[model samples]
Target chain A: MIAFESVGKTYPDGTVAVADFDLEIASHESVVLVGTSGSGKTTLMRMVNRMVDPTQGRVTIDGEDVAATDPVALRRSVGYVMQASGLLPHRTVLDNIATVPVLRGTGKAQAHERAAELMEVVGLEESMASRYPSQLSGGQQQRVGVARALAADPNILLMDEPFGAVDPIVRAELQTELLRLQRELRKTIVFVTHDIDEAFLVGDRVVILKPGGHIAQIGTPEQILAEPADDFVRSFVGADRAERRLHLQQVAGREVVVDASGRAAGVLEQGGTP
Target chain B: MSWVSANLDTIAEQLLAHIAQALPAIVLAFVLALPIAKLANARGWLRGGLTGTAGLLYAIPSLPLFIVLPLMLGTSIRSPVNIVVALTIYGLALMVPSASEALRAVSRETLQAATAQGYAPWARFWRVELPLAGPALVAGLRVVVVSTVSLVTVGGVLGVPSLGMLFIDGFQRNITAEILTGIVLTAALALLLDALVVLGGRLALPWASGRAPRRRTAPRDTGQEAAR
Candidate 1:
């Protein structure tokens, strides 16, 4: 479990990045911190690894204060992913994935074998293992990034806009992949994204932050969509969310429940009314 | 050409001596420049001062440097060490900035990834930064080799054993054939060395080819080609 107790971060320039933030993420839960720019969503995620130290309060993982732990060791124990794949251009995909394991003194043969398995787990072909990150497309590179993060199999995965750099199609595909992986692995994940739809899709609980990293509401996606805490939360979720309330619509002679985007989202069961 | 053929043994000896002097200096300069360039990368003031010092060293005339190196080092004026030291200094002067630029060219994202992946700074420098810097570093080496090759000819003015002796002898004897031969041979040597550097770069950075897995088709378009 990760817990933040009245955590606040103020820059040396006297800018408040995160103010009076408190959150607790249970084990095996995927919690997303959602906000627009300047919301300090990224800052809150980074503070877990001591990449940004909180000035006012403490963050603990499994009840151990993260600030007291060695920074490198703490970072190694948590998996972190970023946008643009953040891959080493000179390294082959396999070597990139093998990096963390090898750093922890795992033998080369074992690390490479683990990397190969992870490539398959992350939906990349074995043939791509020898190719450099530059040789892969944006989507492929992101998958490699995910695989590399999972190579050491840390209990907590910190993802900061992991799919934000890819196209819409690839973004959806990676989200599905993440859902599948989460179901199987059940690792505690802290995800940060500006996309509300993505937060709803991937997060078990969404912590909506206002402009300066102060929580507006904390609830499940269904709860947030059903009952926005305030006007800002309602506006951020958008009016289209109400249309997501399932109602049968006629398309030609067939009836289907259309989603907010006017696409046929699903079909009603036999007894449900339009 | 006739003088060159008749005195082929002497010409060959001078050519070997030229290679002997230039190769070590180029290698030494390359080795030394890496740490200096890495230092320069981390600090702004050090980079500026070091690069400025290199530019000043490079701007000095080779003849003066060659003449004064023995005095500074307490070696005999006739020692080949003078030519070697002078040429090495020139190589370092030319290479330091290139090395800095090459290392700096590595993407910041890649470095951040390495750090997040738990690589210690030194390991990341060797495994990630240096390999990524290969193409630019080799390009720098090509410039250094060609410049050093030509500069070795100038050392002959100080009676250093090099191809430059042919130019002096040709000038003294008024043999245009000897001067022409020396010019041709030096140009050929420079081209050879440049080609070697390019080939070595290819060998070292096979992934830098930027080619996709080959498909058996006439007009297959790779994304990297389009990206360029």
Candidate 2:
């Protein structure tokens, strides 16, 4: 479980990034913080790993204040992914994945064995283990990043726009892979992104932040779609999109709901709520 | 050409002596520049000051430096040590900025990634930063090698037994052939040194060979390409 108690961050230049933010995330739940630029979603996510410490109030994981723990140890204990999929270009994919484990004093042989398994888990070819990150495509590099993050098997995973750099097709594939991984692992995840649709798709609960990292709304995707907390959220969630109407339309024979973007969003079973 | 052929053995001996003088300076300068670079990497003011000092050192005329170094080091001007010391100083001055810039060339994202993965600073510097900086460092090394080889010819002013001897002999006795031989040999030596550096870089950074397929496909249209 993670909790933010009156958490706020003000930069040295007197810019208030996050203010009066409060939230609780249950264990095994995937909570996404969604916002545009200046929403401080990245800053908020970074706090969990102590990359950006709060200037006021506190953040706790399972009732232990994160500020009290050694920053390096705290960071290593959490799985982190970023937009760049920051794999070290010099290290081979296998060594990159094995880094955290080796840093924590695991035997090199054992760590390498675990990294090989992680590469398989992240859907990378075993042959790629010896290749450098620079030799891989963007999607492949992102996969290596995921493999590296998961190598340590941390209970808390913090992802900041991990799929933002990929093409839309690749992004969808990675999203589905994350869903599959989540179903199997069930780690507590804090995801950050600017795309509302992504948050709705991947988040168990989405917390929408306004420009200053102040929460505009926090609810499940269905609840937010059914009832937006305010006008800002309505537009943010694209509630005006035809997909939110939830009306059943016959596609050949099966009833499906199509979004305003002309894509099929969901299918409705017979006599089910649209 | 006849002059070079007739005196092939003497030319060979001088070539060996020139290499003996130049190669050691290059090696020593490369070794010394690394620590200076590492120190100046993160601090802007320090890097600027060090680079400025190196620029000043480089601007000093080789003959004057060659003459002055013996006095400073308290060595005989006739001793080969004077030439070695001066050449080493030149190499250090030339390589300092190259080394620092090469170290800086490693991207911020890569460093952040290393930090996020819990790499202590020392480990990150050795295992991540230095390796990524390999290509740029090699490029710097090539420039220094070529420049040093060319500069060794100037040491003839001090009568430091080298390929430079041909220049001194050619000038005093009006032997155009000897001067030509010296110029040609010096140019060849520079090319040889540059090639060695290139080959060393290839060996060090095998992954750099085919690493940028994506960038190649979308090659940024710099104005030169458009103009062509």
Candidate 3:
């Protein structure tokens, strides 16, 4: 479990990124923080890992306050994935995945073996194992980045716009992969993205952050779509959110493309919602 | 033609003796440069001072340095120290920048990834940082070997038993063939040293073939892994 109790950040220059944020993300839940550029969602997430120290209040991971923990140790147990896939260009896909494990006292042979397994888990071809990040396409590199994050088996994964760099098609594929991985790993993932659709799709809990580190609304996707907190939340999700809701209702189930006139288009039954 | 045929044993004796002297200085320089380069990467002022010292050493004519060292240390002219000092001067000069640049050229993305992986600071420098920067470092060492060979030949100015002494003796005797022999052997030796450096780099740094990473891995993760 992760909790931010009245956390705030006031930079040395007097700029306030987050102000009095109070949030709790339960274990085994994928919570995505979404907002405009300066809404402090990224700052808030970084605080949990102690990447950025909070000026006031405390961020607790499990039961201990992060401020009291060593930053390196804190970060070691937390998997972080940044956009651009942040894969080490000098390392092969397998080595990149083995990086953290090797650091954490795993021997070279064991670490590499685990990395190979992670590559499989992340849906990468074994042939790509020897390739560098530059040698892989954008999507493949991003997948390797994800695999590297999962290498050490951290209980908490912090992803900052992990899929923002990919094309829509590849983005969808990654999102699906993430969902499957989440189901299997059940990690306490704190994801940050600006796309409301991505937030709705990937988040078990979605946070709409207003400017100045204020949370406009925090709830599940269904709750937020059905009942927006205010105009800010409603606008961020867009007017098409209601229509988009229909898409979610059919998720992971089946594809039943029908004509506009409520008639089945292709191999539809004569009576099955045609 | 009779002189060439009759002096073959003498030529072999001189060549072997000269090589024995030159090889030690070159080998010492190669070993010394690796650690100095590693040190230079961490301390800017030390690097500058050390590099500046190397340049200063190079500026002193090999003849003078060889003579001066014996005078200052009260060591005999025939001691290996004089020759070693001259060769090491060139070695450091050549190795300083090559090693430093290799260390500096280490990519930030690689460092970042290593940090994220939980490597402690020093560990990164040793395991991920040094190993990844291997090719450039070895290339730098290659330059060192060549420079050492060249400078150790110069060490003969102090009466050291070196290839330079062979060349100098040939000059003294006006034996053009003997002089040509030293030059040819020295050049071949330089090339052989270079080839060895390249081979060492490839074997030592198999992972260095990939392009540099855009980011540096964190120092923390690097230290942890290196320490392990």
TM-score of each: 0.90, 0.87, 0.78
Question: Per-residue alpha-carbon lDDT of model 1 for A136-208, expressed as tens digits?
Answer: 7777888899998899999999999998987777788889999999999999999999999999999999999
The candidate with the higher TM-score, 1 or 2, is: 1
Query: How well does candidate 3 match the true structure in TM-score terms?
Result: 0.78
Task: Spell out the clash pairs found in candidate 2.
Answer: none
- Candidate 3 residue-wise lDDT, B1-228, digit = tens: 455577777667656766666677667776677688778777888888887777776677777777878888788987877777667666767777677778788877667656655677887777778787777777777777777777777766656665676678889998887787778878888898789778777666555554433323322211222221
Docking quality of model 1: it rates as: acceptable
User: Alpha-carbon error at A95 in model 3, in Å?
Assistant: 3.5
User: Which pairs clash (backbone N, Cα, C closer than 3 Å) in model 1?
Assistant: none
For model 3 chain B, the run of ten residues with the poorest summed lDDT: B219-228
* Local accuracy by lDDT, each model: 0.87, 0.85, 0.78
* Predicted structure with the largest TM-score when compared to the true one: 1
User: Which consecutive 10 residues in model 3 chain A have the weakest lDDT in total?
Assistant: A242-251
lDDT of 2 by residue, B101-196 (tens): 988888998888788877777888888888788888887888778878888877777777789889788999898999888878888998998898
lDDT of 3 at A167: 75
CA lDDT, candidate 3, residue B162: 59
Tens digits of per-residue lDDT for model 2, A1-274: 9999999999999999998899999999999999999999999999998889999999999999999998888888899888869988767889989989998999999999999999889888877778777666677777888888888999999998998887776778889999999999999999999999899989999999998789999999989988899999999998886766555578888988776667788787777565
**lDDT tens readout by residue for model 3, A95-146:** 8888888777789999999999989998888877786666666777778889
**In candidate 2 chain B, where is summed lDDT lowest over 10 consecutive residues?**
B219-228
Query: Which has the better lDDT: candidate 2, or candidate 3?
Result: 2
